[model samples]
Structure formats: C-alpha cells, structure tokens
Target: MSQLFSPLTLRGIQFNNRIVVSPMCQYASVDGFASDWHLVHLGSRAVGGAGLIIAEAAAISPEGRITPHDLGLWSDEHIPGLKRITNFLKANGSVPGIQLAHAGRKASHNRPWEGGKAIFPNEAEGWQTVAPSALSFAEGGPVPTALDDEGLHKIRYDFREAAERALEAGFRVVEIHAAHGYLLHQFLSPISNQRTDQYGGSFENRVRFLREIIDDVRAIWPTDFPLFVRISATDWTEGGWTPNDSVALSALLKEQGVDLIDCSSGGNVPHATIPVGPGYQVPFAEQIKREAGIPTGAVGLITSAEQAEEIIASGQADLVLLARESLRDPYFPLHAAHTLGDDRPWPVQYERAKPRG
Candidate 1:
C-alpha cells in the first residue's frame, strides 16, 4: 500500500491515512460560536475521506480571536455545536481535531474580506490585544499590552479549560496553535518577544510559555489521545525564529508528550522574504523530524497527490496537511487515493461518481 494511504497510529488514535485537512479560518461565526457553516465545512472534509480534519483555530478566549468571527472554545455554550460536528466526522471515519489558538497582538483585526486592518479596542467589533511584549505587528498599527503575570497565569488556565472543553466536545486530537506569529509564537521569536522576564530573552526563557502551556493542556488531555503543536518553523528573516529553534522546541515538546509537530512557516514577520513555491515548507518538516526525532506534518503549497505521496514515501514528513487545496476540493483525499491507485472507500452516496477502476 502507498505510504500516503497507510494508517498512522499516534498515541491510541489510529488515522486511516496520512492526509489531514489543515485548519483554514472561515470568518463565519458570531460571538465565537460554531455555526452551521463550520459543521458543513468540516463535515464535508470528513466525507471526502481525510484521515484527520483539524478545525480552524478556535480562540481560547474572546480576546484571543484573530477576528470577531473566529470560532472559540472558551464557553460551555460552544460545546453542543462542536459536538455535533465531531459526531459527523467520526461517523465518516475521520478524526476530528481542533487548533486551539490565541492571536496575541494580531487579535482584534478586521477579517481578510474586510481589509485586514487592526481595530481599536474602543471601536466596534474590537477589543484590546495582549502579547508577550507591548509591540505592534506593523508600523503605525495598534500596540498590544504586554502580558502581566496575572494575565499570563489566566491564559494558561484558559488553555487547560479549553482542552477540557475539547474533550467534552468529543474531539480526538487537540493541537495547540503555537505557530504563525500568534501568542505562543510571539514569545518564541526574538523579533516579536522583547521581554526581560522568564518568558523571554534566552531560548530557554522564550520557550517557557509554550512549555508551560503543554504541561497545562497535557495535565487535562487524555493520555490515549494525540496532542499536536503547529509551529512556524522559520520567520524567514534574520534575527528571527529559525528551523533550528523548531527542532530544539520539538525535542522539548516530545519530552512533554506532544505527539507531532505541524510544521509551516513565515507568519511571524510581515516583511520576511519567504521563497514561496511548491512544497516550500517541506524541508522544515524533514529537518525537524530528522534532527528532533519527532513526527512532523508538512503543510504549505502541497497541492498534488504525486507531491504529497512523494513526501510521505521519502520519509520527509509523517503527515501531509492540505489547506487551500482542500478548500478547492474537499474530496482531495479520495481523489488522491484514486490517483495513487490506493483504494480508499468513497461514501456510498458518491460511489457512482467514483472514477473508473
């Protein structure tokens, strides 16, 4: 059997194939609730035969949301809608996962469709954003408040509570979104984090926040379920977070019971020159897996069955996550299986549309 279609067992959860639906934000929620849009968006990917479907980054608190419309897990009221989606995903043979996120200084921004500008806390649909350091993501943008000890402690508690809520929502995998210049990544990157405290400066100090979050989440997350950490392997700029940093961090995460690293890049620095191309981020996964001795997921510009198959076949990455391509073709996994001559079952309702054997 093709490795791309092979089963991968992480912790006690068995994935039917290596293809995962990478979390893509659809600014379609209200008050942090998962609406029917989320149900259909995630459910269709499951129906399309992905082994795993990671829901879009769900904020741990209202202030953590990237935009007002981003999904959230901070309230018990959010559970039923998520539970409904998980039920559908599991019934369709896909493991449902969620990327728990805090956007830090990037929070309180207009949605992409709405110009993507920073919104003032006093303005409509906006609130004060917080981060490791009081800095603006770009010139003339709003400056975020540097997190105090009490705020930091609250964020940690929020993560643990979010993990508990995810479990109650029946999610099988819980991925911490430490990548893409978000709250945790802010602490990790020297370019963003400028604190003199225990959570910044030296590598060990910078990684303290993420390490503590892993400890908090794992304390509540079940042992049998997998825990994934999504990280931007590089900032693509000098004096920024690098692939080496990712490898080092992955090593510590592995020791803390993190099952996999979802490797992507270039969200930390707005001006970083990333060589965007096909499978551009795959090398990060390869290096981290080889150097850190941890399983990794390769994402970014991976759009073809052949390309994805080669990645897994070459042992470059243990999993291939598709975002834009999956959006374009929700059934990409089923189509990929057929393209690679790996027989994956199509849903009974769609079997007639399946291509010739």
Candidate 2:
C-alpha cells in the first residue's frame, strides 16, 4: 500500500491519508467573512480527496490581518460563514482545520495582485501594525509599534477567543501560525526580536510569547482534537532562528501538547538567501522529528506523488502539505494514487472519469 494513502491518527482525529491541503491565502474575504469563493475553493480540494484541508491564515484580531482582504476569526459574526465551508468539507471526507495568525508588522498590506506594498496606518483600510520590537520589516518600511504588556495580554486573549470561534465554526484541527516572519515568528527570531524583558532577549524569553499563546489556545481547544504549530524552522540568515533552535522549540512544543510542527523556512527575513528547491525544507522536518521526537509536517515544493511518498516512507515526516502544487491540481492526491498504483476511491460523481485498471 502507498504510505501516502495510509491512515494516520493524531490525538482523536484519524486522517485517511497523509496528503494535506496547506493553508493558502485567498485574499478574497470581505470584512473577514468567508464568501462563496472560499466555499468553492476549499470544497473542491475536499472533493479532490485531500485528507486534511486547512483554511488560510484567519486573523485572530482585525489588525492581525496580512491584507485588508485576509480572512478572520476575531468575531462571532465570522463563524457561520466558516461553518458552511467546514460542513461541506466534512461531508466530502476531509478533516477541516484553520490557521489562526497575527501578521504583526506584516499587517495592513495591499493584496499581492495590487503590488504587495505596505499600507501605512494613515492609509485607508490600514491600521497601526505591532510587533515584539519597533523594527520595520524593511528599511524605510513602516515601523510597527512595540507591543507593551497590555498589548501582549490582548494577543493571548485574542488567540484564546479565536480558538473558541474556530470550534464554533466546526474546525477539527487548529494550527497556530508562528511562522513566515509574522508576529510569533518575529518573537522567535533574535534578528527581529530585540527586547530586554521576559518576552525577549534569551532563547527562553524569546519563546515565551508563543508558549503563552499555545497555552491560552490549548486551554480552550478540546483535548480530543489535535493542535499544530507552523514554524519557519530556519530564518536562513546568520544570527537568526536556526534549525537547532527549531529542534529545541519543537521539543518544548511537544511537551506543551502540540501534535505536529509544520516545518517551513526563510520567511523571517526579507533578503535572506534560501536555497529553494524540491524538498529543500524536508530536512528540517526530519531533524525535528528525530531530535525533538515529535511528528513533523514537511512543506515547501513537495509537488509530486513520488517525492511525497518518499518523504513519508523514509521516515522524514509524518505529513506532506502542498500549497502551489495543490493549487495547480486540486486532485493531485487522486491522481497520485493512480501513479503509485494505490486504488484510492474517487468522488462518486467523478468516478466515471477514473482511469480504468
């Protein structure tokens, strides 16, 4: 049997396969409400046979959005729209998940199609950005306000509340977005976090914020469901967050009841040189899984069935998350089953087109 199609259980959730539809930002929401666009976008992947479908980063607070159009879970009003999508995914045989994130200094940006530039607080649809430090993401870019004790308390509260909303929305898995140079990643990387308090300075202090957020969310998030953290793993710059730090962090997260570490790299710095290629980030997953003794999800350029199969078969990672590849072919898993000679069932409506044996 193809290992990629093999069932794996995490906590109380059983994923029918290792194929996961990684959260890809749609930038299609209006006032953080999921529209029909989101419904079709996510629902199609469920129909395409992904075992798990994680919706894009939903801001824990309005200001946590990466763009004005980013999805959100900051209010009860956001629940019903998301519930509709989750219901469809569940009916179609996919475990629904959502990534709760705070964009931090990365917030208030124009959509990617609109040049991806920063929209200053003074600009329309933009609000003040906040972070661990008052540093700007880029030179001459917007300098975010340094978060104070009150601000930190709010962040934890927002995450806790958002987790409750996610539960109400019918999501079974929750991934805390501590990655991609965002708020939590900013706190983790010394390059971005230059504070002198308990939430910064030493490695232990640097991880304090994220640890607190996890505790806050996990407190309310049910024990039956799995909770995951997506970490950048490596900042890809000297003196930044390293794989060693990731290993140590993963170990701590495992102790904190985190089920998996979604390992990706090089998003904390703007100019860091990343050796981008197929499975380039898999080693981080392998290292963390081995050294930290935790399950890890391998993401980044894992585009093919064979490559994904090898990652799981070789004990490199427990799950493969596809973003762009899944975008190109929503049915990649169904097609992959054929490539690996595994008879994965297709959606009955589409079975008429299934390749004859």
Candidate 3:
C-alpha cells in the first residue's frame, strides 16, 4: 500500500489518506458565504481522491477578509453555504476542513484577478483593516486601526464563534491560519508587532496573541476533533520569526491540544528574498517536525507524484499538501498511486480507464 494512501488517525478522527488539498483561497465568496464555485472547486478535489480538503483562508471576521471576495465564517448565515460544500466533501470520501484566518493590515483588498490592490475604506469594495499595531501594508493600503484590549477580546470572540460555525458546517479539522503575514502571524513576528504591551516587545510577548487564540479556540472546539495550526516556519528575513521560533511554537501548540502543524514559510515581508524552487518549503516542515516532535504537513511547489512520495517516504512530513499541483490535476493522488506502484482504487466510474497495472 502507498504510504500516501494509508490512513492515519489524529485524536478520534481518522484520515483516509495522507493527500491533502492545501487551503487555496478562491477569493470568490460573496459576503463571505460559499457560492456554487466553492462546491465544485472543493467537491472535485474530494472526488479526485484527496483525503482532506481544507477550504481557503476564511476570515473569522469580516474585517479579517483579504479581499471583499474572500471566504468567511464570521456569522451564523455563513454556515449554510459552507455546510453545503462540506457535506459534498464528506460524501465524496474527504474529511472537510477549514482554515480560519484574519488578514490584519492586509485586509480589504481587491482580488488577484482585479489587480490585487489594497482598497481604501472610502473606496468601492473596501473596509478598514485592523492589526496588532497601527501599520499600513502598502503605500496605498489603509492604515490599520490598532486593537486595544477590548478589541483584542472581540477578535478572540470572533475566532471562537467562527470555530463553532465551522463545526456546524461539518468541518472535522480546523486549522488556525497563522502564516503568510496574516493577523496572527502579524502578532507572532516582532518585525510586524511593534507594540510595547504584552503582545509585543519580547519573543514571548510577540507570540502571546497566537497562544491566546489557540487556548480560546481549544476551549470551544471539541476534544475529539483535531486542531491544527499553520505557521510561517520562517519569515526569511533578519530579526523576523525564525525556524527555531516555529519549533518552540509547535511544542507549545502540541501542549495546547494542537494535533498537527501545517508548516509553510515567508510572506511576512515583501523585501525578503525567498529561495523559491521545487519543494522549497519542505525543509521548514522537516525541521519543525523533528525538533518540535509534532506531526506536520509540507506544501509549496509539490507538483509531481514521485516528489510527494519521496517527501513522505523520507519522513520529511506526515502529509503532502498540494496547492497549484492539485489545481492542475485534482486526480494527482490517483496518478501518483499508479506512478509509485501503490495502485489505489480509482473511482469505479473511471476504473475502465485506469492504466494497465
């Protein structure tokens, strides 16, 4: 049997395989609700044989959305649309999951197809962005309203409410989005968190917001269900969040009931030169897993079946999450199984077309 196709259990939930559809933002939701686009986008991946399909970085609050088109779970009404998507995923043999995120100062932007500009609140299709510090991400981006203690509590409350809705939407796994220079990552890195309060100034303080959010979320999320945290294993810049910091954070998260760490890197700074290449981000996953003693998923530029097989075989990561590759070929796992001689079951409907094995 292929290691990638092998089932693995986390807490009381068992995944059918190790192939995960990495959360890729569709930037297609309307008012943060899942649309018909989401159903087909996510459902096809499940049909293509991914054991886990995580929805894109869904904002826990409207202000957390990266673009006006970003997916959201901030309100009760969002549950129905999400439930429609998750129900299909589960029916198609995938454990539906969601990544709850807040874009921080990066919020209120236009979608990538729309030039990806940061729109001002007064401008059409825009709202105010908020963050740990009052910072502007770009020259034209709005200066975020820094969160006071009261606002901080509300943010936490938003995450809790979002998690609850995710449960109602049939998500078995909830991965907290703390990577890619988002709100939580904004708080974790000293480079972005310039505050003098308990949420900044020191390493411990810089990570306080993430730790607090994890604790708050775990309080409401069920014990039987798995909780994962995705962290930027490195900011790829001097005086930024480092691999060592990720290891420490992973250890802490494990103690806080986090089952896995979805490891990725960079995006905290525009100036940082990331050495991008095939499997460019796998090393971070390896480092975090070995040192932190936590299970992790490796993503980024993982495009081929052979590449993914080696990643798991080499113990680089517990799971291989494909983003672009999965988009290009939703049946990546099926192709991979054939290429690796693992010979997994292709759907009965397509068995007649299976390569001669």
Candidate 4:
C-alpha cells in the first residue's frame, strides 16, 4: 500500500490519507466574517478528497489581521460562518482545521493584488500594527507599537479565546500560525525582535510567547484533538532563526503536547535569498522529525504524487501539505490515488470521474 494512502491516527482523529490542504488565505472576509467564497473555496477541497483541510489563518483579534479583509475569530459572532464551513468539510469526510494568527508588524497591508504595500493607520482600512519591537517590516512602513506586558497577555488571551471559538465553530484541529513572518515568527527571529524583556533577547525568552499561547490554548482545546504549529524552519538569513532552533523548538512543543510541526521556510526575512525548487523545504521537515522526535508535515513546491509519496515512504515526513498545487487541481489527491494505484474512495457524486485501474 502506498504510504500516502495509508491511514494515520493523531490523538483520537484518524486521517484517511496523508494529503492535506495547506491553509491559503483568501482575503475575502468582511468585518472578519467568512463569506460564501470561503465556503466554496474550502468546501471544494474537502469534496476533492484531502484528508485534512486547514482553513486560512484567522486573526485572533482585528488588529492581528494581515489585511482588513483577512478572516478572524476574535469575536463570538465569527463562529456561525466558520461553523458552516467546518460542517461542510466534516460531512464530506475531511478533518476540518483552522490556523489562528497574528501578523505583528506585517499587519495593515493592502491585499497582494493591490501592490502588497503597508497601509498607514490614517488610511482607510488600516490600523496601527503591533510587534515585539517597534520595527516596521519595510522602510516607510508603519512603525509598530512594541507590545508590553499587558499586550503580551492580551495576545495569549486572544489565542485562547480563538481556539475556544474554533471548537464552538465545529473545527476539530487547530494549527497555530507561528511561521511566515507573523507575530510569533517575529519574536523567534532576532533580526526582527530586539527587546530587553522576558519575551525577547534570548532563544528561551523568544519562544516563551508561543509556548505560553499553546498552554493557554490547550487549556480549552481538548485532550483528544490534535494541535499543530506551523514554523519557518529557517529564516534563510545569517544571524536569523535556524533549523537547529526549529529542532529545539519542536521538541519543546512536543513536550507541551503539540502533535505535529508543519515545516515550511524562508518567509521571515525581507530580502533573504531562498533556493526555491522542487522539495527545497523538505529537508527541513526531514531534519526536524529526526532530531526533534516529532511527526512533521512537509510543504513547499511538492506538486507531484511521486515526490509526495517518496517523502513519506522514505521517512522524511509524515504528511504532505499542498498549497498552490491544490489551487490548480482541487482533486490532486484523487488523481494521486489513481497514479499510485491506491484504493482510496472518491466522493460518490464524483465517482463516475474516478479513474479505473
């Protein structure tokens, strides 16, 4: 049997296959509410046969959003629309998950198509961003307010509350978005975080914020459900967070009850050169899993079924998460099953289109 098609259980949840839909931000919400676009965008992937479909990063608070239009779970009112999406995913046989995020200094930016530039607080649809240090992501960008003790506590509270809302909204898994130059990643990388407080200056202090957030979230996230953390295994810059740091962090996360580390790389540094290619980031997952003694999900440019199968079969990573490839072909898993000659089932409505052996 193909390892990609083999069932794996994490906590009490059993994934029918190793394929996952990596959370891709839609930037289609209004006042932090999921709209019909999200329902169809996410629901189609579930119907397309992904074992797990992680919803895009939903900001824990309005200010944490990457853009004004980014999805949010800061309020109880955001539950209804999210519940609708999770219900659809679950009913279609896919595990529904969410990524709770805080964008830090990268917040208040225009959508990608709109030039992806920072929007000043005085501008419409923009607000003051916050970070571990008073640094702007780019020159002339809005200078963020350095988060104080109260601010740090509030962020942890926000994350805990978001996980509670995710549970109430019918999500079964919650992956904290600590990667991709977001708030947590900012603190983790010394390049972005320059503070004299307990939340910065040293490796231990930098990870303190994320570690405590996990503790707070796990308080209400339930023991039976699995929790995942997405981390940038390397910042791709000298003097920035490294793979060794990721290995250490993963072990700490495992000790704190995290089930998996979704390993991706090179988004924290603004101008760091990354050797982007097929399976370029797979080594990060491989190293983390081996050194940290934790299961890992490999992501980044892994578009082919053979490559994905090899990753799992070779003991490199336990799961393969597809992002842009899933957008091109939502039914990539179904196609993969056919290519690998695995007996995975297709949705009944689409069974006629399933390839015959």
Which lDDT value does model 4 have at 232? 96
> Higher lDDT: candidate 2 or 3?
2
Q: Write the per-residue lDDT of candidate 2 for residues 53-165, one digit (tens) a residue.
A: 99999999999999999999999999999999999999999999999999999999999999999999988988999999999998888999999999999999999999999
TM-score of each: 0.99, 0.99, 0.98, 0.99
Top of the candidates by lDDT: 2
Q: Give the per-residue Cα lDDT of candidate 4 at 22.
A: 99
Which rank order by TM-score, best down to worst? 2, 1, 4, 3
Which residue pairs come into collision in candidate 1?
none
Q: Give the per-residue Cα lDDT of candidate 4 at 162.
A: 95
Candidate 4 or 2, higher lDDT: 2
lDDT of 1: 0.95
What is the lDDT for 126 in model 4?
89
Query: The CA-based lDDT of model 2 is what?
Result: 0.96
Tell me the spans in candidate 3 whose CA falls farther than 4 Å from its real position. Answer: none
Q: Mind sharing the TM-score for model 3?
A: 0.98
Can you write out model 3's per-residue Cα lDDT over 192-211, one digit (the tens) per residue?
A: 88999988898889888888
| lDDT of candidates 1 onward, in order | 0.95, 0.96, 0.90, 0.94
- Which model, 1 or 4, shows the larger lDDT? 1
